[model samples]
Target: MREIYNELKRHSGKLTEFAQVLVDRGLYTNTKHCVAMMRHSTQFRQDVQDIYAEWKPGKLKTKDTATHNAKLAEVFRSIKKKELKEKVETMCEILEETLMTVTLAIKHSDVRKLGEVKANIENILYGEKQ
Candidate 1:
């Protein structure tokens, strides 16, 4: 802000005094220019992305975990179309841990062996619906 003020002082034929609105407009214009420059900077973009990642790490992880597990849940549906209608218990916890393991395994598997990994997991944990 002071930099903008000094520059404005020197720019208009080295004026010693300026109107209040001119100073205000100079500050506003400088702010907008700085914002535009930041918007165009790759480092600024990365900094913003880092801030968002820092802001909600847990929420983002939970959402990602849900999405990843949904893929595993589709495998579950291969054996049964039924949804748990009861107040499920520790078994649900076990099932979730097991599913999460498989989900992570599938995520880390080699691209070439993806189909094999998925097929093997489904064969072991579930079978055809009919």
Candidate 2:
């Protein structure tokens, strides 16, 4: 749980701490609602188990990414292949750009931009040019 919260923090600052607090409160509120619903509705109680199933894989993914990224960073620090380093650096930039763009698209409900991102990812993965 501490690691999970630290992962949520992602960076150090008072604002980040405040953000965590806000997230905690939001979760608390939603959990209370869920409990109330569960008491009142059989469907809500049964349906909530699926949410846990979905979240379990995501939690594992979060931990796995942290481990994977640390190893990648370590490898990059010792790696002697300039070409591989340059390619990895370029890929990192592409990933950062995609992360930001996809986040903004989802936040704004921009379906068209999301579709474009899908095509971009496909092109990158399959060696197809737009």
Per-prediction TM-score to the true structure, in the order listed: 0.18, 0.35
What are the lDDT figures for the candidates, one per model?
0.46, 0.55
Per-residue lDDT for 22 in model 1?
30
Q: Give the deviation of candidate 1 from the true structure as CA RMSD.
A: 21.1
lDDT (tens digit, per residue) of candidate 1 on 1-130? 3333343444553222222333444432454454444334344344333433453333222236877899989989764544443324444654566566667767887355555556645644664345
- Top candidate by lDDT: 2
Compared with the true structure, model 1 gives a TM-score of 0.18
Please report the TM-score between candidate 2 and the true structure. Answer: 0.35
RMSD from true fold, candidate 2: 25.6
What's the residue-level lDDT of 109 in candidate 2? 89
Query: Native-vs-model 1 lDDT?
Result: 0.46
Rate residue 64 of model 1 by lDDT.
68
Candidate 2, which ten residues in sequence have the lowest lDDT sum?
42-51
